[model samples]
Target: MKRLALILTLLSAPAVAQDAGLAARDAAEALEAASILLDTAEDSRDRVAALTDTVRAFEDGLAAMRDGLRDAAIRETELTRKLAAQDAEVAQLLGALSALGSRAEPQTLLHPQGPLGTARSGMLVAAVTPGLAAKAAALRSDLEEVTALRELQQSAAKTLEDGLAGVQRARTDLSQAIADRTDLPKRFTEDPIRTQILISATETLNGFASGLSQITENEVAEVMPPIEDRKGILQLPVRGVIIRQAGQADAAGVTRPGIVMATRPSALVTTPTAATIRYNGPLLDYGLVSILEPQGDLLFVLAGLDAVFGEIGDVLPAGSPVGLMGGDGGDIVSLTSEGGGAGRSETLYIEVREGGTPVDPLTWFTTE
Candidate 1:
């Protein structure tokens, strides 16, 4: 009986993969949402924001589809390897079962030891047969699962391609919508000549930041709600991974009082809280930048963008798109690369200042 029980090892392995189909279903739902949004895009009050949501949905759907396919491939390979590894044990079980099953009960009952031996043999065969049936059923289940996973991978390829195309279209529409937006209220107008003079005279970021108000045409301050109360609980301006914290030295051994983040190419940048745009334009070596004031003397400076949205002095709502990270919209390249890793290829630098002094941004924003 013990020897026969060992035969079950040829089929014994708990399901190693979860329902990969669930991920594919989630992807389908997200893609559907994107499609609906695109169809009704022109009716949207804030087309820029609406299109941003659509693009994000497509991105999520593509990621989910890719993950589902990857998981299915992995599971199928594991099952195949397991089956190959236990081939010898499977043959052993089959041979042993054939001998036991080929015998007739009546012939066995006519044993040399008479009725007692015959009855014992009969009992042994009956006891082993049911257990064998259960194991055979489990083995069949695993084989079926492998087949299903293989078929899923094939179908998901089309879904993934559609998601990619949809997201690209949304991105293009979002760019156009942003270009047409002109309804935001302005706190104050900017003076280009004064800003140029300030930039030319300043030797460092601190000097330039300290004199930000000099470029403004209006001295009258707009009274906004208190943001100090929301300190230490603000969201990040962009979705990314923090590569460097405040005061961290880089490869050049130069330290900066800011947070450096790595993000996917062309990722949307947004405001963590409702704030007025203090400045928005190219400055110094920073590609393009936007300076925001969320409170009385607090400034949030975001640098290294491919494009900047909204004019200087425009008051933006929380989560408003400020700009896009520099990239040509290849978000899935890293996902399919040799490393099989995720993407975070663009760099964004964020600096927070209070009362003309630099502070740790992590203290004000929560990160994953």
Candidate 2:
């Protein structure tokens, strides 16, 4: 009886040990599952944050574009009123000229005199004719200005329409990008304190450029494709005619090395190559400028934009939308050669630099 009791106790002990082993295995699996869930939650949170930032950026860009459109509309209305006034003035001038022509014969008859008087009258006519010619020339110049202004107004309207469409497209793309949640590798995170300091400290282009140069000194170099091999093969950032090429003197006699393109108002600007944006904002006389670096020692500067998109340090693929030209106001006097036609035109200045030396962009882009 004692032996049977001892055997029963051993059997119960083995059963109890087996149960403990099973419980330990279950706890280990549960802990691993919990850890996995925690990791997944953290990943999801990071993704959500990235998506939010992207959406916010898109919203800001859309707002800027809309603001530009509104400003253009206001400019258009003002130009229309000025054009109407100019038309009335031109008509009044024409009427006055007609009256003068009609009275010429009578005035000559009423002044009955001899050969000496006739010679005096001829001299008077010569002086008066020159004055009339000057007035006519002035009228023609005014008419040309009116025509050009009207063309700009029309182009602004077209640009507004195109901008609306572009905004909608960008919205859709932003939504899609968020949904996809693509995990793009980060190049470098911006130091908020440093960026703020740079923003507040730099007032001029040279100052801002100096700050950027300093910032880049500490950045890890990124591998990029060779840009030197693509000379004359790159597409123009904006579609237009090269009205002014590098080294050409502008009306101001400022012979800065760059290409000035006469583009349709509100024309969309695009990236010419895969590049990282270094600077994007108003600088000096260049209305909104964007600086892109495609590879080592190569920088592309695009100026005269109305609105710019993408933040500094953003890596963009080739042909990505960069910004839009605000086609509202123009230096009509400077644009006489190009804007004298029926179409409205805006100017864009592009410059390429290698190792701080300006290079002709015509050699890199397909201007035709």
Task: Tell me each candidate's TM-score.
Answer: 0.78, 0.47
Please write out the lDDT profile of model 2 over residues 1-368, one tens digit for every residue: 32223223223333322232232223223323333333343345554333333333332333333333333334435545765777866677677578567447735623457777777877877677777768788656544444443433343333334334433443344344434544433344456567567867877554655566554433557856888889888998875677787999999898877888876555667788888887788777788999888887788899999877666667777766677766542222221232332233678899988777788988889855
Top-scoring candidate (lDDT): 1
Clashing pairs counted in every model:
0, 0
Instruction: Give residue 14's lDDT in candidate 1 (0 to 100).
Output: 32
Clash-forming residue pairs, model 2: none
> Could you tell me how far off, in angstroms, the CA of residue 168 lies in candidate 1 after the best superposition?
1.8
The RMSD of every model to the true structure, in order and in angstroms, is 7.9, 30.0
The Cα error of candidate 2 at residue 109, in Å, is: 56
* Model 1, position 19: C-alpha lDDT score: 65
Best by TM-score: 1
Residue 367, candidate 2: alpha-carbon lDDT: 53
